[model samples]
Target: MVDFIVGKYNYWIYIVLMMIGFYAMIGKKNLIKKIIGMNIFQTAIILFYVSIGCKKGATLPILGHAHGHAGQAIQTSAYINPLPHVLMLTAIVVMVATLGVALAIGIMIYLKYNTLEEDEILKAVK
Candidate 1:
Protein backbone atom coordinates (compact mmCIF):
# COMPACT_ATOMS: atom_id res chain seq x y z
CA MET A 1 0.00 0.00 0.00
CA VAL A 2 2.85 2.35 0.88
CA ASP A 3 4.61 1.46 -2.37
CA PHE A 4 1.48 2.14 -4.37
CA ILE A 5 0.99 5.53 -2.77
CA VAL A 6 4.64 6.46 -3.15
CA GLY A 7 4.76 5.42 -6.79
CA LYS A 8 1.59 7.30 -7.64
CA TYR A 9 2.25 10.52 -5.77
CA ASN A 10 0.90 12.64 -8.64
CA TYR A 11 -2.47 10.96 -8.31
CA TRP A 12 -2.48 11.65 -4.57
CA ILE A 13 -1.63 15.30 -5.14
CA TYR A 14 -4.32 15.65 -7.77
CA ILE A 15 -6.85 14.02 -5.50
CA VAL A 16 -6.02 16.40 -2.67
CA LEU A 17 -6.28 19.40 -4.99
CA MET A 18 -9.58 18.16 -6.37
CA MET A 19 -11.02 17.70 -2.88
CA ILE A 20 -9.98 21.21 -1.91
CA GLY A 21 -11.62 22.61 -5.03
CA PHE A 22 -14.76 20.56 -4.41
CA TYR A 23 -14.97 21.88 -0.87
CA ALA A 24 -14.48 25.46 -1.97
CA MET A 25 -17.09 25.17 -4.69
CA ILE A 26 -19.70 23.68 -2.33
CA GLY A 27 -18.82 25.49 0.90
CA LYS A 28 -18.27 29.02 -0.37
CA LYS A 29 -21.25 31.33 -0.54
CA ASN A 30 -19.72 33.75 -3.05
CA LEU A 31 -20.17 33.21 -6.78
CA ILE A 32 -16.66 34.43 -7.61
CA LYS A 33 -15.15 32.03 -5.08
CA LYS A 34 -17.02 29.13 -6.67
CA ILE A 35 -15.65 30.11 -10.07
CA ILE A 36 -12.14 30.17 -8.65
CA GLY A 37 -12.74 26.75 -7.18
CA MET A 38 -13.87 25.50 -10.57
CA ASN A 39 -10.66 26.79 -12.13
CA ILE A 40 -8.67 24.98 -9.48
CA PHE A 41 -10.54 21.77 -10.17
CA GLN A 42 -9.98 22.15 -13.90
CA THR A 43 -6.27 22.69 -13.35
CA ALA A 44 -5.96 19.63 -11.17
CA ILE A 45 -7.74 17.50 -13.76
CA ILE A 46 -5.50 18.76 -16.55
CA LEU A 47 -2.37 18.08 -14.53
CA PHE A 48 -3.59 14.61 -13.73
CA TYR A 49 -4.24 13.84 -17.37
CA VAL A 50 -0.90 15.17 -18.49
CA SER A 51 0.80 13.14 -15.80
CA ILE A 52 -0.85 10.04 -17.18
CA GLY A 53 1.07 10.52 -20.40
CA CYS A 54 4.43 10.54 -18.62
CA LYS A 55 6.68 7.54 -18.19
CA LYS A 56 9.68 7.24 -15.83
CA GLY A 57 12.40 6.91 -18.48
CA ALA A 58 10.60 7.61 -21.70
CA THR A 59 11.12 10.14 -24.47
CA LEU A 60 8.54 12.00 -26.54
CA PRO A 61 6.81 10.01 -29.27
CA ILE A 62 8.76 11.53 -32.10
CA LEU A 63 8.55 9.46 -35.25
CA GLY A 64 11.80 7.83 -36.33
CA HIS A 65 14.84 9.17 -34.55
CA ALA A 66 17.01 11.22 -36.91
CA HIS A 67 20.25 9.88 -35.51
CA GLY A 68 19.39 6.20 -35.42
CA HIS A 69 21.14 4.03 -38.00
CA ALA A 70 19.51 1.41 -40.21
CA GLY A 71 18.57 -2.00 -38.64
CA GLN A 72 18.12 -0.45 -35.17
CA ALA A 73 14.53 -0.83 -34.04
CA ILE A 74 12.82 1.69 -31.80
CA GLN A 75 11.10 0.25 -28.74
CA THR A 76 7.56 1.47 -28.11
CA SER A 77 8.04 1.34 -24.35
CA ALA A 78 10.74 4.00 -24.54
CA TYR A 79 8.29 6.56 -25.83
CA ILE A 80 5.64 8.28 -23.68
CA ASN A 81 1.99 8.24 -24.76
CA PRO A 82 0.94 11.55 -26.31
CA LEU A 83 -2.81 11.06 -26.49
CA PRO A 84 -3.56 12.08 -22.92
CA HIS A 85 -1.51 15.25 -23.29
CA VAL A 86 -3.33 16.17 -26.49
CA LEU A 87 -6.72 15.53 -24.95
CA MET A 88 -5.81 17.61 -21.92
CA LEU A 89 -4.96 20.55 -24.16
CA THR A 90 -8.47 20.43 -25.54
CA ALA A 91 -9.84 20.18 -22.03
CA ILE A 92 -7.90 23.29 -21.00
CA VAL A 93 -9.40 25.32 -23.84
CA VAL A 94 -12.87 24.20 -22.89
CA MET A 95 -12.21 25.00 -19.25
CA VAL A 96 -11.07 28.50 -20.18
CA ALA A 97 -14.19 29.12 -22.27
CA THR A 98 -16.48 27.93 -19.50
CA LEU A 99 -14.63 30.00 -16.93
CA GLY A 100 -15.05 33.09 -19.10
CA VAL A 101 -18.78 32.48 -19.36
CA ALA A 102 -19.09 31.85 -15.64
CA LEU A 103 -17.20 35.05 -14.84
CA ALA A 104 -19.41 37.05 -17.16
CA ILE A 105 -22.48 35.70 -15.43
CA GLY A 106 -20.93 36.46 -12.07
CA ILE A 107 -20.27 40.03 -13.16
CA MET A 108 -23.86 40.43 -14.22
CA ILE A 109 -25.05 39.12 -10.90
CA TYR A 110 -22.79 41.52 -9.00
CA LEU A 111 -23.89 44.45 -11.14
CA LYS A 112 -27.50 43.71 -10.37
CA TYR A 113 -27.18 43.17 -6.61
CA ASN A 114 -23.76 44.73 -5.78
CA THR A 115 -22.87 41.47 -4.02
CA LEU A 116 -21.33 38.20 -5.16
CA GLU A 117 -22.71 36.13 -2.33
CA GLU A 118 -25.17 33.37 -3.27
CA ASP A 119 -27.40 33.93 -0.24
CA GLU A 120 -27.46 37.67 -0.85
CA ILE A 121 -28.42 37.13 -4.47
CA LEU A 122 -31.19 34.75 -3.43
CA LYS A 123 -32.53 37.24 -0.90
CA ALA A 124 -32.38 40.03 -3.47
CA VAL A 125 -34.16 37.87 -6.00
CA LYS A 126 -36.86 37.08 -3.46
Candidate 2:
Protein backbone atom coordinates (compact mmCIF):
# COMPACT_ATOMS: atom_id res chain seq x y z
CA MET A 1 0.00 0.00 0.00
CA VAL A 2 2.80 2.41 0.78
CA ASP A 3 4.54 1.66 -2.49
CA PHE A 4 1.32 2.16 -4.45
CA ILE A 5 0.58 5.47 -2.81
CA VAL A 6 4.14 6.73 -3.10
CA GLY A 7 4.51 5.70 -6.72
CA LYS A 8 1.24 7.31 -7.81
CA TYR A 9 1.50 10.56 -5.90
CA ASN A 10 1.05 12.60 -9.04
CA TYR A 11 -2.33 11.03 -9.62
CA TRP A 12 -3.37 11.92 -6.09
CA ILE A 13 -2.32 15.52 -6.63
CA TYR A 14 -4.24 15.71 -9.87
CA ILE A 15 -7.34 14.27 -8.20
CA VAL A 16 -7.13 16.86 -5.46
CA LEU A 17 -6.77 19.65 -7.99
CA MET A 18 -9.74 18.34 -9.94
CA MET A 19 -11.88 18.25 -6.81
CA ILE A 20 -10.91 21.78 -5.90
CA GLY A 21 -11.87 22.99 -9.33
CA PHE A 22 -15.11 21.02 -9.26
CA TYR A 23 -16.07 22.46 -5.91
CA ALA A 24 -15.27 25.99 -7.06
CA MET A 25 -17.42 25.56 -10.11
CA ILE A 26 -20.35 24.06 -8.23
CA GLY A 27 -20.22 25.88 -4.95
CA LYS A 28 -19.11 29.37 -5.89
CA LYS A 29 -21.58 32.11 -6.62
CA ASN A 30 -19.39 34.47 -8.63
CA LEU A 31 -18.99 34.02 -12.37
CA ILE A 32 -15.28 34.81 -12.33
CA LYS A 33 -14.67 32.18 -9.68
CA LYS A 34 -16.53 29.64 -11.76
CA ILE A 35 -14.46 30.48 -14.83
CA ILE A 36 -11.27 30.18 -12.80
CA GLY A 37 -12.47 26.81 -11.55
CA MET A 38 -13.06 25.61 -15.11
CA ASN A 39 -9.54 26.65 -16.03
CA ILE A 40 -8.15 24.81 -13.02
CA PHE A 41 -10.05 21.70 -13.99
CA GLN A 42 -8.71 21.84 -17.54
CA THR A 43 -5.18 22.35 -16.24
CA ALA A 44 -5.49 19.34 -13.97
CA ILE A 45 -6.65 17.17 -16.84
CA ILE A 46 -3.74 18.29 -19.00
CA LEU A 47 -1.30 17.60 -16.19
CA PHE A 48 -2.78 14.16 -15.68
CA TYR A 49 -2.35 13.30 -19.34
CA VAL A 50 1.20 14.63 -19.45
CA SER A 51 2.15 12.71 -16.29
CA ILE A 52 0.73 9.45 -17.61
CA GLY A 53 2.76 9.77 -20.80
CA CYS A 54 6.01 9.74 -18.84
CA LYS A 55 7.93 6.59 -17.93
CA LYS A 56 10.60 5.66 -15.39
CA GLY A 57 14.10 6.10 -16.82
CA ALA A 58 12.59 6.52 -20.29
CA THR A 59 14.12 8.76 -22.91
CA LEU A 60 12.33 10.63 -25.63
CA PRO A 61 10.71 8.86 -28.57
CA ILE A 62 13.33 10.16 -30.96
CA LEU A 63 15.36 7.39 -32.51
CA GLY A 64 19.10 7.65 -32.04
CA HIS A 65 21.28 7.75 -35.17
CA ALA A 66 23.20 4.60 -34.26
CA HIS A 67 20.06 2.47 -34.06
CA GLY A 68 18.91 3.36 -37.59
CA HIS A 69 22.32 3.16 -39.27
CA ALA A 70 23.61 0.03 -37.49
CA GLY A 71 20.42 -2.04 -37.85
CA GLN A 72 20.12 -2.36 -34.09
CA ALA A 73 16.91 -3.54 -32.45
CA ILE A 74 14.93 -0.60 -31.19
CA GLN A 75 13.64 -1.09 -27.67
CA THR A 76 10.16 0.39 -27.52
CA SER A 77 9.97 0.37 -23.74
CA ALA A 78 13.00 2.62 -23.41
CA TYR A 79 11.14 5.61 -24.83
CA ILE A 80 8.23 7.56 -23.50
CA ASN A 81 5.07 7.77 -25.61
CA PRO A 82 4.83 11.18 -27.29
CA LEU A 83 1.15 11.12 -28.24
CA PRO A 84 -0.25 12.32 -24.92
CA HIS A 85 2.24 15.18 -24.72
CA VAL A 86 1.39 16.25 -28.26
CA LEU A 87 -2.31 16.08 -27.53
CA MET A 88 -1.82 18.11 -24.40
CA LEU A 89 -0.04 20.80 -26.38
CA THR A 90 -3.08 21.13 -28.54
CA ALA A 91 -5.23 21.07 -25.43
CA ILE A 92 -3.23 23.91 -23.94
CA VAL A 93 -3.85 26.05 -26.97
CA VAL A 94 -7.53 25.29 -26.80
CA MET A 95 -7.57 25.98 -23.11
CA VAL A 96 -6.04 29.39 -23.65
CA ALA A 97 -8.51 30.23 -26.38
CA THR A 98 -11.36 29.07 -24.18
CA LEU A 99 -10.11 31.13 -21.28
CA GLY A 100 -9.90 34.22 -23.42
CA VAL A 101 -13.41 33.76 -24.72
CA ALA A 102 -14.73 33.03 -21.26
CA LEU A 103 -13.12 36.16 -19.85
CA ALA A 104 -14.52 38.21 -22.68
CA ILE A 105 -17.97 36.84 -22.00
CA GLY A 106 -17.56 37.56 -18.32
CA ILE A 107 -16.62 41.12 -19.13
CA MET A 108 -19.68 41.48 -21.28
CA ILE A 109 -21.84 40.10 -18.51
CA TYR A 110 -20.36 42.47 -16.01
CA LEU A 111 -20.88 45.41 -18.32
CA LYS A 112 -24.50 44.54 -18.96
CA TYR A 113 -25.54 43.35 -15.49
CA ASN A 114 -23.20 45.58 -13.44
CA THR A 115 -22.26 42.61 -11.25
CA LEU A 116 -20.42 39.28 -11.53
CA GLU A 117 -22.52 37.29 -9.11
CA GLU A 118 -24.77 34.61 -10.58
CA ASP A 119 -27.48 35.10 -7.96
CA GLU A 120 -27.49 38.85 -8.49
CA ILE A 121 -27.63 38.40 -12.24
CA LEU A 122 -30.55 36.02 -11.92
CA LYS A 123 -32.36 38.41 -9.65
CA ALA A 124 -31.82 41.25 -12.06
CA VAL A 125 -32.97 39.12 -14.94
CA LYS A 126 -36.12 38.12 -13.14
Candidate 3:
Protein backbone atom coordinates (compact mmCIF):
# COMPACT_ATOMS: atom_id res chain seq x y z
CA MET A 1 0.00 0.00 0.00
CA VAL A 2 2.80 2.38 0.83
CA ASP A 3 4.56 1.58 -2.41
CA PHE A 4 1.40 2.17 -4.42
CA ILE A 5 0.71 5.46 -2.67
CA VAL A 6 4.29 6.66 -2.97
CA GLY A 7 4.62 5.73 -6.60
CA LYS A 8 1.45 7.49 -7.66
CA TYR A 9 1.25 10.47 -5.30
CA ASN A 10 1.12 12.94 -8.18
CA TYR A 11 -2.06 11.38 -9.52
CA TRP A 12 -3.68 11.78 -6.13
CA ILE A 13 -2.69 15.42 -5.95
CA TYR A 14 -4.09 16.09 -9.42
CA ILE A 15 -7.32 14.39 -8.49
CA VAL A 16 -7.71 16.57 -5.40
CA LEU A 17 -7.01 19.74 -7.37
CA MET A 18 -9.43 18.71 -10.09
CA MET A 19 -12.10 18.09 -7.50
CA ILE A 20 -11.63 21.51 -5.95
CA GLY A 21 -11.89 23.18 -9.34
CA PHE A 22 -14.92 21.12 -10.29
CA TYR A 23 -16.63 22.06 -7.05
CA ALA A 24 -15.81 25.72 -7.52
CA MET A 25 -17.24 25.73 -11.02
CA ILE A 26 -20.42 24.01 -9.91
CA GLY A 27 -20.97 25.41 -6.40
CA LYS A 28 -19.79 29.00 -6.72
CA LYS A 29 -22.35 31.76 -7.24
CA ASN A 30 -20.12 34.49 -8.66
CA LEU A 31 -19.24 34.52 -12.37
CA ILE A 32 -15.61 35.40 -11.76
CA LYS A 33 -15.25 32.61 -9.26
CA LYS A 34 -16.59 30.13 -11.75
CA ILE A 35 -14.13 31.33 -14.38
CA ILE A 36 -11.30 30.96 -11.89
CA GLY A 37 -12.48 27.45 -11.12
CA MET A 38 -12.50 26.53 -14.79
CA ASN A 39 -8.95 27.78 -15.12
CA ILE A 40 -7.89 25.70 -12.13
CA PHE A 41 -9.51 22.62 -13.61
CA GLN A 42 -7.75 23.23 -16.93
CA THR A 43 -4.40 23.61 -15.18
CA ALA A 44 -4.94 20.37 -13.29
CA ILE A 45 -5.70 18.53 -16.50
CA ILE A 46 -2.63 19.97 -18.25
CA LEU A 47 -0.41 18.98 -15.35
CA PHE A 48 -1.88 15.49 -15.29
CA TYR A 49 -1.33 15.01 -19.00
CA VAL A 50 2.22 16.33 -18.87
CA SER A 51 3.03 14.07 -15.93
CA ILE A 52 1.71 11.07 -17.81
CA GLY A 53 4.22 11.66 -20.62
CA CYS A 54 7.22 11.65 -18.29
CA LYS A 55 9.35 8.50 -18.13
CA LYS A 56 11.82 7.36 -15.51
CA GLY A 57 15.51 7.76 -16.47
CA ALA A 58 14.53 9.13 -19.89
CA THR A 59 16.34 11.84 -21.87
CA LEU A 60 14.93 14.41 -24.25
CA PRO A 61 13.94 13.20 -27.73
CA ILE A 62 16.83 14.95 -29.44
CA LEU A 63 18.85 12.43 -31.45
CA GLY A 64 22.48 11.82 -30.74
CA HIS A 65 25.23 11.54 -33.37
CA ALA A 66 24.94 8.63 -35.74
CA HIS A 67 27.50 5.93 -34.86
CA GLY A 68 29.65 4.68 -37.78
CA HIS A 69 29.20 1.07 -36.60
CA ALA A 70 26.09 -0.80 -37.95
CA GLY A 71 25.31 -2.65 -34.67
CA GLN A 72 24.59 0.55 -32.70
CA ALA A 73 20.84 1.08 -32.32
CA ILE A 74 19.05 4.02 -30.71
CA GLN A 75 17.03 2.73 -27.80
CA THR A 76 13.45 3.96 -27.74
CA SER A 77 13.26 3.70 -23.96
CA ALA A 78 16.07 6.22 -23.60
CA TYR A 79 13.97 9.09 -24.94
CA ILE A 80 10.75 10.48 -23.48
CA ASN A 81 7.67 10.77 -25.68
CA PRO A 82 7.11 14.34 -26.92
CA LEU A 83 3.56 14.10 -28.20
CA PRO A 84 1.95 14.73 -24.82
CA HIS A 85 4.09 17.82 -24.33
CA VAL A 86 3.05 19.23 -27.71
CA LEU A 87 -0.60 18.45 -27.09
CA MET A 88 -0.47 20.12 -23.69
CA LEU A 89 1.06 23.20 -25.29
CA THR A 90 -1.85 23.38 -27.71
CA ALA A 91 -4.30 22.82 -24.89
CA ILE A 92 -2.77 25.64 -22.87
CA VAL A 93 -3.10 28.04 -25.79
CA VAL A 94 -6.73 27.08 -26.24
CA MET A 95 -7.41 27.40 -22.53
CA VAL A 96 -5.92 30.87 -22.41
CA ALA A 97 -7.94 32.00 -25.43
CA THR A 98 -11.12 30.59 -23.93
CA LEU A 99 -10.45 32.22 -20.55
CA GLY A 100 -9.86 35.56 -22.26
CA VAL A 101 -13.15 35.34 -24.13
CA ALA A 102 -15.01 34.26 -21.03
CA LEU A 103 -13.53 37.08 -18.98
CA ALA A 104 -14.47 39.58 -21.64
CA ILE A 105 -18.04 38.36 -21.54
CA GLY A 106 -17.99 38.55 -17.75
CA ILE A 107 -16.80 42.12 -17.92
CA MET A 108 -19.53 43.03 -20.32
CA ILE A 109 -22.10 41.44 -18.05
CA TYR A 110 -20.70 43.28 -15.06
CA LEU A 111 -20.79 46.58 -16.94
CA LYS A 112 -24.43 46.09 -17.77
CA TYR A 113 -25.66 44.59 -14.49
CA ASN A 114 -23.04 45.92 -11.99
CA THR A 115 -22.92 42.53 -10.27
CA LEU A 116 -20.74 39.45 -10.81
CA GLU A 117 -23.09 37.12 -8.97
CA GLU A 118 -25.07 34.83 -11.25
CA ASP A 119 -28.26 35.06 -9.18
CA GLU A 120 -28.01 38.80 -8.99
CA ILE A 121 -27.37 39.07 -12.70
CA LEU A 122 -30.41 36.95 -13.43
CA LYS A 123 -32.54 39.11 -11.18
CA ALA A 124 -31.25 42.22 -12.88
CA VAL A 125 -31.92 40.74 -16.30
CA LYS A 126 -35.50 39.90 -15.34
RMSD of each: 2.1, 2.2, 2.6
Question: In candidate 3, which residue pairs get closer than 3 Å at backbone N, Cα or C atoms, i.e. clash?
Answer: none
> Which residue ranges in model 3 land beyond 4 Å of their true spot?
64-72
Question: How well does model 3 score by local distance difference test?
Answer: 0.90
Q: How many clashes (backbone atoms < 3 Å, residues ≥3 apart in a chain or on different chains) does model 1 have? A: 0
Q: Which candidate has the highest lDDT of all?
A: 2
Q: State TM-scores per candidate.
A: 0.88, 0.87, 0.88
lDDT of 1 at 109: 92
- Residue-wise C-alpha lDDT for candidate 2, range 45-81, written one tens digit per residue: 9989989899888998777676555776677788898
lDDT of each: 0.90, 0.91, 0.90
Determine which window of 10 residues in candidate 3 has minimal summed lDDT.
Answer: 61-70
Cα shift from native, residue 71, model 2 (Å): 5.9
Write candidate 3's Cα lDDT for 1-126 as tens digits. 999999998899999899999999999999989999999999999989988988999988676654553478778788888889999999999999999999999999999999999999999999
Regions more than 4 Å wrong, model 2: 62-73
Off by over 4 Å in 1: 63-72
